[model samples]
Target: MSTTLSKSYYHATSSVSLSAVTTRDLLDSVAKKTPEKEAYIFPVEKVRLTFEELQRQVCTLGTGLLSIGLKRGDTLGIISSCAPEYIMVQLAAAYIGVVLARFHVGLPNSLLKSALLKSECVALVVGANNDDVYNQLELILPDLKTSHAETLQTDEKSKLQRIITNVEASQGRWKSIYDIMNLCKKDSENGKQRLEETSKMVEFGDPYTIFYTSGSTGPLKGTLHSHMAIQNIYMMCADRYEWTNDDILLSACSSLSHATSEMSHIAPLILGMTSVILSPGAKIHDNVSVIQNEHCTVLFSTYPGLYNLLHHGKINEYDCSSLRYVMTSASTIPTDVIQKVSSIFQAKVLHTYGSSEALFVSGRDITADEKEIIDKVGRPFGHTEVKIVNEYGKIVPINTQGELLIRSNFLFRYYIHDEDKTKQVMSVDGWYTSGDLAKIDRNGYIKIAGRSQDVIMKGGKTMYYASLVESLLSHPNVKAAYIVPVPDEELQEDFCACVSLIGDTSISSDDLKDFYKANIGIPAYIPKYVMVFDDFPEMLTGKMDQKMLTLEVFTRLGLNKEWLVHGRKA
Candidate 1:
């Protein structure tokens, strides 16, 4: 472990004393009460699992994990499609007190290697069905390199010694899905007995999950979150959203890769609701079908995925009367898009804003007049204390744009093994610097301006990517937009609009330019250019990689030779 600690204002306000129960405890609690009640329903496969059955499988595989010498505080890398057994592994890790770090399988080989290395994962668990992933890992095994490889691996002999568990097992190391389920059935007979012994040993505040933050600057960083932190976040968000035991939930976004799915899954599961797991490779068409067929009442998706759904024209065909709460985060949700979705689905469309370091800081009830709260990220998620602070750590007045800082019981434990990186965001006192700039109105509603890195300055006024992109997304013909700054001889930097048009909806550059000039309302003095791409390059977690886009533009525009700011002069 790293010895350095960075000062965060959040540390002074509170301690990491949140109470959390192990996954086994949670499953056992639900099993004892819900018993035969259905907890998960895989609508596509027509498969279902009762609480008792789910708990039964968890304990046995937990034994499978332990049988391979897997111990508490060890990390397991899980890369697979959404499966009952995959979920079982996560539960089993929580049950036995091992931390589960789920890797995004869709990431490029290089990025995936970065995550695996950064997490120092002892054993990697990939699904039997995903043979491609298995092959990819094997293909790159010997060549896998990272900064921490040597420090993370050694053949020391001690009871406290750490080594790879999943990959090094003499037997059952790469157990198949069928193998685990078969063993789970055999262990069901002793489930009750095993549960009793493990229940007494598990402790709250122990690390249960290590979620990697979607890095925009470099490789992703693993953020360690405790079981207690998970529970607190789940309870807070569930209460604020009025999530009930009966609500059917679905996530079109990468729930398996994000903290939203990480924490939000707890509520419906703990409350005895049936969770519908959308299949991998699920496009916009599949999403509509899943909601209609599964009778899904709540859907949590990112802005891009939702936008894709709207543009595909499949949303209106589905009988989506079952939906009640439709929440979006990760990126800004357009007001016009929000209003259209609400009108079509007749459900509440909520726009939420936060990060992996801090989940659900604020949300707006964007059920009506999407424009009203579209610019605003919304009010803080129930009881969360938010402040706009300047560089000196002093609070800025309302409506003044500054760094958005948050103080909540739900901050992450630490940036996993990266103290220097942890200090960059968290203060020793107890506040988390979001790296986002925002302002609050007298009504307590918060409106985001842009990310600190994404803000562009022209003349003396600053133009936020969020506001600029929001304007482009408002156009009926535009599907998605990215405002990437490019090099300029006059103003040091100019704005370039890279857009993805609606599917089958064609409009020329001149048409777009005319529309922007008439509708966007930007200053004429600022240099503006438009480039249309089939699709923007996206990070593994599905967020736009503006840095990559900038690099590509620099090369294409012949500006890389002398441009500052890598691609744009600043």
Candidate 2:
């Protein structure tokens, strides 16, 4: 029943004075001590914001929000590309205990509107150049896109298309970014006074954000978190990962995902480190340049993006020797991908597993051995307890694969209003069932197999789709992979892999099958069919839509009759 961190290596070696401060207090303290130290690096434009300056801007925006009668615990809808302004607004909302109902600008405007309306956002702040956002809103009510040229990217083909599609000239309700900033800046002198008012009675347990599940499975639901959750991440990273204020962290990936929400956004900001924020519409090439030019010490990216960087030979050319850590999350990384990326960048890559409902559970610790790195996600950090359980919630034996249930120092309030779904998955006894299946070794390192629903049973042997997908993704030519279990008259169920390869790479399906069989140690089960794709259909958060991929496979190969033998078709 205890939530306190056990007296382990973390408790024995460290001074625990950091426990007293919350995330909001951490930001305020950093602003005071290192006001002029660079707080953020803009990788696209090479712009950097000092800690003090960032706080000042946050305060100004906070005052502007307060003047408009926003209150604590009120949700503020934010949809914009990554910018210093975005960071400013995020911090301002945190300072006032405003729960951030964050939405990525890339999200379909229809989905964005639904989420906003559901969160009941009292106020909204957006980038000046978001014509797409305004146009989408204009279909319902009057709004304007911000006309700031600097915030808008001119050359990107996809970005331009979005802009054109969303902006309607006839609608007059849109507001300009210039006008909003001007008003906030004019009232900058009173920003601190506003921050004081917001923080006067705020506490560590107060809710600060409500991030949505990436919606890979179903409709997106908001997961509520308190400042205590943010502080828990900061403490765990500092206590275990050797993070410090001197580290220069670059989050080229958007901060909306569950992994980046904790790692890139909260970890660096609360630790008083220099964070490099990517400009909206920034590319991977721009990230390489930032690493070299900005002397980025730490890097964070998704599994596919990490592979894409290495496969394109971008990592070899960049002078990123200053880099010490590279982390990937939301999915597992292949051993081959890690070995190549490590050799090229000369930095250790860490893999972590968690959910939007709970921040972090198990991570591949840097200090752990190669076997721990490859075979398992490392031991739990700080006050987190990981348990492997059966269908009845009974604890499973070590080295036995079961659903991963996490009991952490922090947990989300609820999944918005979906109380039924919340209670079904999140146990009242402090455990949140991850829906992911993993086996805990005797040493306590956990190896992820696949999601419980994603596991396929054939002839009484369970085949993990993710384990197969991880193997295929390790191939040099495979840029990304998806595995689908289709019904087979011979085997009951069999897996077929769909892969998106690197451009102009002429690797054949036979070659791929041989590669996986040789490397992964399973020849007969190495995917009966391997289909290649040029690009993947992704949800707004950049994670591949497996459901859509499966549907495509169903249509192309007509596998629906094969797989839907017992269960109804979705």
Candidate 3:
């Protein structure tokens, strides 16, 4: 094992050795080791599966795919919410050696079609909750309603009718998940034979899943991860968090499309832990009940998720003592929120830093000091190396902000079918520039300043929006804060602070300006305008959509199109 510690960089090779294993093999191993252990629980749907049951379902689904003519290495698109079918399809796709491409259920029709076409998906699995999927299918495949084809039946007769109607219109173009399952039952023996042969053919380095980044800034790009990378990263995390078969993990995050949901789906399968998947739109109290009843050991969520739970004002009514760790990421979490979450759940708040391109880079331990827990995103994982470099590609000293570059065995293979775009972010030597401005302290803790694009240039000096937002978040009335740059004829660009306050508490624009001047003490850093709202527009991943917020600010201020720095028109 090799470990390096220096002011300019930090590197550590994992002390825990990992052997080559496919996701299918990993699940089979766990099922053999602990067949009776509960593997998945969906409280809202009233569904439960043991490790053996999960493996059986995955095999059945894999055979069903083979029976329906889905070849190995073919891309399968899953457009669904977090449900048992989603998990089953994900695991089954891996078993059949197909690349499972996740399609955000909330994506627009245009982008959704683009992703499907780009990934060359041969089949799609959709959910039945909302009519959005049917509506999108109408626009994408107009002939779907007119064709005659086999369709799946659901308990809801009306929903099943609508799905059949659409599937008929597709003219045998796509197969419904239910239809495929029925086909699997007809060819169980053949599917089992084929599943065994195909499982042996799958290599550890083959792509397992493709996740598209949340396109808050621009168009979404598809990222591919090998089976080895995904399995090892989650194994490392399971070790880091000391998870075991006895632990029950609960996730209130968004759909399985995002990386956050990977913890709920992938980690449990590898470690033989039980994962509770609450349906989308579940009430905060319902989540609390899952913890209290299921005795969940870990609650994984975004910062806003935990904040809303705490804001519900009934945490005291629920027994959350079983929770040992509250894991959060995807945005900057205020110090006050961290303290309140720890107090409410009686669990340590652990923060993690990762992106779709890079799987799991760094995280803070639950036993970290309060200051480190609140301020830094902790040290890099044992298998990862991190360094901060200036624009000149030179390493920066400790405590100095620069672009963060990471080298890890868990990084994605590349952006699918976009070598030019992939080359822009990743270097030949395996360093993936994160496009995040950050700093490392002498103690090796990493502090993310902000995204490089989020920097506001004022009077020839750099100002970080995250720093300003963090400063304002310290105020008692502020619930969330964001800063964006607006065009200025004289200064080139000016800063605008968008704030959402606590319930029934109002802070005036003048008062905010005064507060900033008193606290920050930087005249140029003070916001030229303060915009308050009941809530900020959020992306699917639960992070504030700064791009949308900026446009809202421009329209509210009645700024001219020419005055906008990015030339965004009204």
CA RMSD (A), model 1: 6.4
Q: Lowest lDDT 10-mer window, candidate 3?
A: 157-166
Which parts of model 1 are misplaced by more than 4 Å? Answer: 1-20, 143-173, 177-196, 365-372, 524-527, 561-570
Query: Could you tell me which 10 consecutive residues in candidate 2 have the lowest summed lDDT?
Result: 157-166
lDDT of 1 by residue, 1-570 (tens): 011122211111112233456566677788898889777766545678788888777777776666555677788888866556567777888888888887776667887766766676777777655656755764446322222342233223212222222322212334554454455456554644554565467787788788777777566878787776677666656666677777878866654767776644576455677777665556677777888887888887778777777778477688888898788885465667777778888888877787778776877643334555666766665446777878787877767877889877667878876899889888888878888877876556677777777767665456788877877776687877887676566766667778888777878766787778887666642237777788888877777887789878767777664454355423
lDDT of 3 by residue, 1-570 (tens): 222346659885566777588978888999999898889999988999999999888887788888776778988887777488889989999987999998888777788767876787766776655456766866765444454554432222112222321233244445566666677777678777888999889999998999998886568899999998888888778877778878999998866788768888887777788899887767878878889999999998877778888887377887888999988875467878888888778788888889999887888865567865477787787788899999998999888899999998899899998999899999999999898989987767788888877777776677787887877676678898888677776777787888888888977878977888787766787788888889898776566777788789988988765555554221
lDDT of 2 by residue, 518-538 (tens): 877765457877888887778
Q: Relative to the unseen true structure, what is the C-alpha lDDT of residue 515 in candidate 3, on a scale of 0 to 100?
A: 81
- Per-candidate clashes come to 17, 6, 5
Pick the lDDT winner.
3
Ranking 1 against 3 by lDDT, winner: 3
- Could you tell me every candidate's TM-score relative to the true structure? 0.86, 0.86, 0.93
Question: What residue pairs are clashing in model 2?
Answer: 35-52, 128-146, 143-173, 143-174, 144-174, 487-562
